[model samples]
Target chain A: MFNLFLKTMYDKRIFIIAWSIGLAFFAYLMLLFFPAFKDSGLDQLLATLPPELKALKGMIGDISALSTPSGYLAGQFFDIRMPMFISVFSVILAVGLSVKDEEEGYIRTLLALPLSRIKLLFGKLIAIVVICVATTIATVSGLYLGALSVNVNLDWTVVSNLSLVMLLLSICMTTLVYCIGLSTGKRGITMGLGILVGAGSFLLTTFAKSVDWLQPYEKVSLFHYFPAVDIVKNGISIWDVVVLVGITILSILLTIILFRRRDVR
Target chain B: MTIQPVLEVDAVTKYYGSFLAIQDIHFMISKGEVVGLVGLNGAGKTTIINLIMGFLRTSAGKIRLFGEPVLPENAHKMHPKVGFATGDMSLFTNLTGRQYFAFLKRAYKLKDDKKLGELCKQFNPDMDKKIKTLSRGNKQKIALISAFMSGPELVILDEPSSGLDPFMQQKFLELINHEGAKGTTIFMSSHYLKEVADVCSRVLFIRDGKLVKDVSRAELESSHGKAVHITTSRAIRPPAQSSLLGHQKTANGYEMSFIFKDSPIKLQQWLCSISYMLDFTIEDHDLESAFSDLYSKDKSEAKNV
Candidate 1:
């Protein structure tokens, strides 16, 4: 399993490095712009703006959320952009890990070894999960570094909990991509569904916040359960954690079952 | 006690949706048997091979390797005993040949690098070069080396010599012979008749997704005839009592070719009865002629039907 994991990650070094560094840089850059806004009294100026415009800026809940370093990081990054970034990264890795091998005829050679198919897939799955964790950590650490550089010490408790939420969201989205890719063995389908679901969830979340009638539809979006603002403003919800974790486990189980049943093309 | 065969494909059938690729195929290879699968393009040879390798799910029937039923989920258990190479397989283009071998070694959990090093030297592949840069023949050599380096009990090769030069082809034959001598069962497919006849103990001929012929090497050597090619001074029709296989016009008036599956003296007597031949040459019937004869006969039979 470890060998398979190493081999799967072998060709993905560039992708992992680029996404991790990009996420970290985005965090650093976003945090770098925060103090200037705080010093210029733009937070109060922003508070006076119309609610719809605020929702457009991805600030739907508390106006105070953007005033602090933790709230600013979660509200600006984790709520919208971070989930999008992580979902894209996760989908690429997961889909590539599950389907690309069979497409490239690598699975035949691997299956010819003494390892079982389930074990081989699990190896690739574990590698993808590890990559997701690394990118998440990089983004969170960048947030921490940017916060400390400005002498605005972040609450580790809230930061860790928020990171966990992001990671769970990533797991749920990636496993969905994996299941689709494994079942269909078509990169196009996996990618199309991945983007539609990954980015679409965010779209639904924002639309739900902006429109009163669409608010009920937010429950269907995976992003709804993460509640980045809720984590930042109040505390992490155990029920939300349960929902995200449950979705991930269910997706994985379904992926494995469907993969075993489908023919390897 | 009767020893179990190395491979037993019993009543195996495969269908791709509504199109039947191979149907009711049955064959067995005992230990140390070198069997050659031969056919024209799209003759279901590759389909059968993929079925045995568990790359495709059998629409019906079963394949047993070393007495163990082979299925997609349990296919890996047979991997340690089976080494397979195919022209259709795609290698990782990004990795150097050496890196790819190292990766396989790790997957197989084998510690010996000496076999890989020896194969690299024997095949003379640029080990450090990326696979995408190598020529097709060199990539083929890489695949062959990977298949044989492990000294597996059963080696499956599909058109293994397709991209090889004459020298490498000879080496590959020698390798197959060496493996057979070591009691390793080898199943291969090829277009080269003489090579298959030289190394394989038995040959399986498939046509239109059916096993049409299965003959042993001894049977082929004794019963296969010689081809007689005769050129006439004029475009004269065959004699009213002639049993020639085929007659076609050449630069010369006409040339007639046919297999004489009888004593050379009888063939000479039959030739003596023909008075108009200007030139004639009798060549020993090889696997190629015998195979072509099978197809020609099949076509005539199909037309008659």
Candidate 2:
């Protein structure tokens, strides 16, 4: 299991490094523009907007808090941007590890080794978690350094809490994709369903605020548990963490069970 | 003391959805035996190999390796004692051959690289080049080396000589012979009849998801009988004999050929009964002719059914 883990990590080293650098740079760029938005009288502009346009604010956060450091960062980055980017990354990673490998017959080489299917999958899961944690740290570091450069007094604890939630959310997305990939062993299905779930969850949660019919079902969407604006203002919520962690664990168990029952290529 | 077979496939059946890939396939290989599985494409050779390797589970029945049942959960425990290589086996494309070997070495928990070095020297693969950059034959060399490097007790190969040149194929056969001499029971699937005849002590013929025949080399040679060619003086009706197989007439009904499985005395009596017989010759039957005869008979049987 350790050997498989080490090999997976080594194989994905370049991928992890590239995502970390890219996400960090993106976060830095977003922070660089935060000061401009704060000084541009955007609050008054947002307040004067029509109600129909105002309803779209659910996708980001409270329009009134757009001028504050925590709210601006949450609304612009953590709320939608970070989750979208991480989800995309998670889908690709999961598909590559499962469906792509099987389709290309590379999984046969690994299976021929003296390791059980469960160990092989667990090794890959650990590697995915490590990559997600590394990228999250890079994003947080970029945010902290960007804030320092702009002389913004930011609370590091709340930011870390938000980062933790982001990490869990990304892991949840990855495990879901991994489960689908291993279950179907089809690249198209895995990617399509992975993107749908990630994007669908975010859309459902966002529209739930304005669309009364979607409110009760909002909890079904993974993004509903990830209230980025609330996390930035009020620190982490244990219930949200529990929900994400529960989904991740369930996805992992389902992945193992399905993968074990199927025929490998 | 009775010795246990190295591999035992007991009435194993596999189905892909509703399609029966292999049904009630049964075979066994003892130690120091080199067995070959011969079949046409989609003949369930690979399916049986996958089942034996525990990459696919048996729908009905069981497969055991080294006296333990081969289940996906416990298959890995037997993997250290088994080496598997397939023609289409994919390697880590980004890694050099050397790196791939290093990973395998770690996975197998080998004490030293001695066996790997020996295999590299024998196969002469370019260890410094990435696998993706290598040719098909070169990649196959890497696979063969990896399978043999661990010095497994039982090696299973599926079309192991697919991309190999004749020279490399000869080298591979020599390796199989050498390993077999060391009491390593080897089971391989191949389309190359000559290769099977050269190295395998026993050959199993699979056709349409069933084990059609299993014969040892000595039994195959003795039981297949002789190829007979006879020239007649006139266009007379050919003698009706149940032992005659694949009978064909040419040269305006003067020349006739068939496989004679009956005794030599019976052949002589039948030949003597034909007064217009001009000339005749009988020779030992070859495996190629035997294989074709078996498949052709099967095709006719299927058509009849």
Candidate 3:
């Protein structure tokens, strides 16, 4: 069983390395420009702008805090851009494990071995989760190194905790796509649903901020659970953690059920 | 006392959303038997192989591997004892051929690379080359080497010789014969009748998802009597009332053939009664022509019905 997981990781080593470096570069750039934004008084100018414009730009909360290292990184990078990047990577990796192999005809070879379907499915799922965590670590490491170079004082413990939350959020998104891929075994359906959910949730979460009526429906979106500005300011929420972890577990169970019941071809 | 069959497929039927791919399929393979599943394209040969491998679910009836009902849950138990390869064998494009086999070696948990090395020596595949860069025939060679390297008890191959050159095809046949001699039960499907005729102890002819004929080695080789080509003093046609499978005009006189449901001596004696017959030559019917005749006869009979 571990052999399959190890093979998958090895097969996707290049992808993991590529995505990790790309996200890390993005994180480094976000931290590198922190002082320039604060020193140039753009933070003050942005603070004067209306909330609607900030939300439109995916700032999602107060812009005055853009001068602060944690606020700028979390609000601009983690809250919107980082999560989007990680979620998309996780979904693609997850689908590649579950459905892409089927399309490419590797699943038949795997199934011909003396291993149960549940074991194979679980093995691939575990590999996807490991990849998501590894990418999160990359993002956190880049941010930490970039912050150190800029002489910014950041609470390392808090940064680790935030990274954990990000990892869970990635897990939730990945498993959601995993379930769809396992149930349908069609690359088009899996990719279509993945993009729809990822993009739609971001849109709904942004819209719910100004419109009070959409607030209730925001809970349906995974993005609503991880409010980057709120997380950076007040620390992690027990409810959000529970929701992310719960949804991941639920999605995994649903995936296993569908995979065991559906036909291999 | 009788030994249990290695495989037993009973009245199995399959449907792909109202499209019947196979229906009422039944067969059994005893231990060490070399059986061939013969059919044209779309004849459900692959479907039956998929069903036995537990890739597809049967719509009705039961399949047994070692006398136990074959469900997906229990199918894996037979995997270690069975080796399978299909003509539609696709490989991981990113990995070199060596890496893919190394992965399978781990997946199947073979003791070491002993068998793998031996197979590589036989097939002569460029193990270092990426599969995407290899030709289709080379890919098939890799698949074949993988299937046979493990020395499985039951080897199932679909179109095993497809894309192989004549030399490798002969080598493949020899490999199957060696495996059968070692007491392995082999079930293979192929459209190439001569290939199957060379080694199979029995052949099952499937057409349009039905088992149209079941022929044993004896029946295949000699049941159809010899074809008699006669040369008369003059160009003479066969008597109109003669009983024979088929007759046609040749340059000399006339030639005819029939299934000698009786002895060859009786057939020869009957043919000798032709008054104009001067010289004649008799040859056993070849499987290719025999199968062709069977198919055409079935078509004409269906037309009458």
- Residues A1-265, candidate 2: write the lDDT tens digits: 8877888888898998999999988888888888888877867887999877777777655556667878888787888777778778988899989898898887777888898888888888888888889999999888878898888877777788788899999888898898789877888999999988888887887898778788899898888777888887778889999998998888888877878767886
| Residue ranges of candidate 3 with Cα displaced over 4 Å | A40-64, B223-284, B296-305
Instruction: Let me know the TM-score candidate 3 reaches against the reference structure.
Output: 0.89
For residue B56, what is the lDDT in candidate 3? 72
Q: How would you encode candidate 3's per-residue C-alpha lDDT over A147-212 as one tens digit per residue?
A: 888888876766776787888888889888887887778888899989888887877776776676
Per-model C-alpha lDDT, please? 0.80, 0.84, 0.79
| The 10-residue segment with the lowest total lDDT in model 2 chain A | A57-66
Give the candidate number with the greatest lDDT: 2
TM-score of chain A of each: 0.91, 0.93, 0.92
Clashing pairs in 2: none
Clashing pairs in 3: none
lDDT by residue (tens digit), candidate 1, A1-265: 9987887677778888988888888887878877875566656876888876766554443344567877777777678777777667767777777678678887767776777878877887787788789888988878877877777878888889898888888877887788788777888988888888877787888777667788878888888888887897788898898988888788778877766655676
lDDT tens digits, residues B1-305, model 3? 98899999999999988899999999999999999999888999998998898877789989998887876656778888888887778677777989988877877888888888978888898899998999888888898887877778888999989988899898889888988898999999999999998899999988889988888988777644455556665555443323256556677566554444456667667677777776777766567766776566443322100
- Show model 2 residue runs off by greater than 4 Å: A45-53, B223-226, B229-243, B246-257, B260-273, B276-285, B297-305
Question: B76-104 in candidate 1: lDDT tens per residue?
Answer: 88988888898755777778988888877
Q: What is the lDDT for A32 in model 2?
A: 86
DockQ of 2: 0.77
